[model samples]
Target: MLKPISTPTRELVNLDGVWRFAIDSRAGAEPWTGLLGTPLEAAVPASYNDLFVDPEIRDHVGWVYYQREVRVPRGWGGERVLLRFDAATHAAKVYVDDELAGEHVGGYLPFDVDITDRVAAGERFRLTVAVSGDLSNETIPPGKIEVGMNGKKKQTYFHDFYNYAGLARSVWLHSEPKTRIADVTVVTGFEGATGSVDWTVVTDGVDEARVRVSLSDAAGAPVATGQGASGSLTVPDVTLWQPGAAYLYELTVELLDEGDSVIDSYPVAVGVRTVEVRGHEFLINGEPFYFTGFGKHEDTAVRGKGHDDAYLVHDFQLMEWSGANSFRTSHYPYAEEVLDFADRHGIVVVDETAAVGLNMGVVGGMTGTPPFPTFSEQYAGAATQAAHAEHLRALITRDKNHASVVMWCIANEPASNEEGALEYFTPLVELARELDPTRPLTYAMVMFATFKNDRIIELFDVVSLNRYYGWYIATGDLATAETYLHGDIQGWIDRTGKPIMMTEYGADTQPGVHSVWDQAWTEEYQVDYLAMNHRVFDRFPQFIGEQVWNFADFATSNGIHRVEGNKKGVFTRDRKPKAAAWALRARWRGLEGRKPGSDGSTGAGSGEVTGADGADG
Candidate 1:
């Protein structure tokens, strides 16, 4: 869908703040007819799970209700009024007063509805959105609903992260003229400092409107202009967007009438760059690029998967301070605000779909000793595949314009070794490539999907592996872990001969816990674990990138396997640096062995690195 923006012919009003919220128990009908019963206030653009101290609210399964009041601006009488929900977890249904407006599935992506018919202009009416967290085999990121001992439904999934659901992003009231720009897609490239932008404009409701496109430099000076619905614009002496150094050009698309009067206008921030996989290197703008960062989650202290601008800025700042150049939105897509920041700051991103835990026997496989067939009729069958494809379509359409998004990860740790693995992923891979052919594609392969067992590794452009030798397998046996790691890498190299990247590899470490020897879950051990992995990575030319498992600790489902939450973060959930953070800073910044003082400050680095330069140190 076209993102709502304020233009001369369009208006956007942010409807984000406190709203009346209640947990749904299927107790009644016609919920849109009156005020919410026993409604408690909830902050929009945040997950409601951690906002309350009540355990029932935190663990409540199934659907929930969020109600707010909105007024159709009197001036919008002639325009199309729509309600845009940036995101609603899993599934949602919109009700304008007593009429159902629209319904949508998929949690991470945005959905909208035209409320024009339900509400009159200048009239104040109720806007209610019902959000559900329940999942089935037919949904993306599939899971099940189980009744607990208390006879209340609870969500069960294979992933480790908490299922913090609700309205986790901004909602907007927007309006546009009858004839407006519907969609805009742009592809950027550069050859010897001259950048080319191929642009397409899709218009709605207007058949005779003239199309005009223009490109402006960061200084707001016009550089190139064109007339047509689809064409290419070239800028001489153009600046390229690079890692740690971002440059943007504004692309403005406008619709005009026969009299040359402007009817609609929309601008997109364009970063002129190209991404490709060349042998053992990933290239951006014709230069060899390395991915060094983390697989991050949109999580915070109380937000719990919510998109917070403050945390967004801080997280990027911390990543920069640690010399990271890129990151993957690990298991799912993150907020668009985060991607916009990455484009502005020149941070590379490996954008992914919300297709986590699709595997049957390994990470999210059957609960029994034998894993159930993953691609069976009861699991991720045709319906699940369709959902997954639509998810990819929306993801690419929404994010394909960003320069920071260089690669698209189709899934994280799927059971690619299973029977239907190859058949299931073939079309999705084609769809991703067909939708956006400018960038490479990858999927984070679980450790179980080895070269011998994996059936779909050769289909992807790059080999992305999430190997946890020291943590899950060797467990403090680095000497033995090194052997296993080497074998795995060599096997992958011999199997594919394609460039490989480590999307995840880290040990859980508590901040204050220290150990001098090779141990797991200790600060010193975290440092050692990273060093060992890097040491092995440096020896292989096929290993082109290394994005650690996590940037910071995050909340997860309560279990004996976790203490408070996942401690694999180099930094704490509060953004405090652990010993591994310093080790990373040292190696990534070309300095190492710098110990922190008692005041939680980093000391001088040792200034010794072997894995080349720039993030690899």
Candidate 2:
């Protein structure tokens, strides 16, 4: 399942415009035989939930059908044509010319079906896709869809985000040779002044084939070359991809015929570096790299969870402006373009899964409160674990080669203290390690999990904690919150001798509300909360990274707890800088020119932030 890298010989057609859309609310809709001509039109790579004004259409909790007509290029005959959908939420089924093509479970990953035979036989093809955003006890981000007192279905989950559904990414038709290179796995390291690249090329149609791997510098100069399906190459003078001074090498894999003529080639972008955890230190290229960034979500106005190029470029620029060197794909993996940008700009990413809000009934069992039914021990059985394992394989197979993805975060705030949590995560952790041992594995531990109850912490290479000492637990008391935060973090350090990363720590702040002093939901309060966390973070040498809860305000499900979505973002929803944004900019800027392995005594101080310029203030 190696991701396809575009080459000059490859043919690609993007299907990314308006398409006929309709909702199958009756749940009687079947692919390849049902309704044909729908009048309503929606963007192909957009969310159907947010496009409509009607409440029923906005909150429709059933199958969404998208139909379009595509003409396969006449030259694509004899070649393997792939009908690729970049992403479809929760579940998706594809049909071509009223024939079942493929069905895929789980979303946020790419899936494709071979249509070479059919495409060669037809001039025009009818393409249809049915997508479901439904979640249950059996799903990864487990939840329940129950009828409320008002006779309307309500979607309730442990996560604090909206369930946006549709073809959230791209759709395309790509042509490849019948016998081609299927995958390329790369592991890079340094040997003295030179760099080493060890790789394995997996091919289909033949057990053995002639493969040639060539390496080039950014300026298109040949550095090193090799000839084999699996071998190693040494570059004399390699440029290491460093923070602020990012560099990249171009890797080209060519598939040859028996006569040594090239049949197909894959152009890949790779960085020469290594990531490892040494004792309590997280190192990148043998340097103690401190991460200063946010736990970001792929969300914005109107688009909801849809991928947009404008927002994508804007976010990377803002991250650079804020002096951030890294960020985690908080709850799930983002679109492929986002990671490409991170690689180009030298931003480290802790790539995470969509496995958020997986807490079960165990937490409340100790107390008197009723536990969550969807995440109980009944749901964490063999079936659920198998589904999760498949998702991990798809994700790792898709993103294992990216230079920006420094670590792999298997889950976010899962119920590590639950009854079956250990049993469930044990195989998953082992599976991820078996898949890619080059990267470190971690899961964001919830505050509810203490030293005595939690067992999953010992399994991970790094310890990632999402603690809210002053916000959720201590209300608004930073004085008392400091003591609680210090003790909890120290206890974890004593328990596991691994590097600690604060994956989430922030206070929600409304846009306009201001207070001279610290008041809840005020701009000053967020600034104060961040300052306290920074002060405490400076005390520990084992603390390697500090990623805030959110990078910007995002849309979420309507609930009493959320005020116009999560306001924990340093920037507003429209990408405007709040007071806390300026505070962070100043703090991160001070650490800009410093070397990687430095002990910081430079604490952040108060600063005056300005108003929004071009956008509405």
Q: Taking the candidates one at a time, how many backbone clashes does each contain? A: 2, 0
Q: Relative to the true structure, how large is the alpha-carbon lDDT of every model?
A: 0.83, 0.80
TM-score attained by model 1? 0.94
| Model 2 stretches astray by more than 4 angstroms | 26-31, 149-152, 361-377, 593-617
Q: List the residue pairs that clash in candidate 2.
A: none
Candidate 2, residues 1-617: lDDT per residue as tens digits?
Answer: 54544676678889999887878864244645755546677897888888888788788777888888888888877788988888898899888877888898888889988877666634888888989888876676666798989987777665777888899898998888888888889889997789988888988775355888899999999988998888888988778987666788988988888888878788778888999999988889998888899999888877778899999999989999998899999788889889888888899999998887666532343241225532344555666677788888988998998899999999887767666677778889999999999999998877666655676887899988887767876768998777777776677777887888889898889988998876889999999999988888877788888898889998888867687888889999899998998998999988775532257343322221111010000
Residue lDDT tens for model 1, 1-617: 78898888889889999998888763266578888875488899999999988887888887788998998888888888999988899899998888889999998999879877777788998988889887888888888888879887778786768888999999999997778888899998878878899998899866533889999999999999998888999999999888888999999998998788888889999998888888867778776676789989888988898899999999999999998889999778998999999999999999999998786665332221225688888788999999999999999999999989999999987878788999999999999989988889999887667777789987898998887767777789987677777777777777787888899898888889876787678888888888888877766766778888789998888878689888889999999999888888877776222211113222221211111000000
- lDDT for model 1, please: 0.83
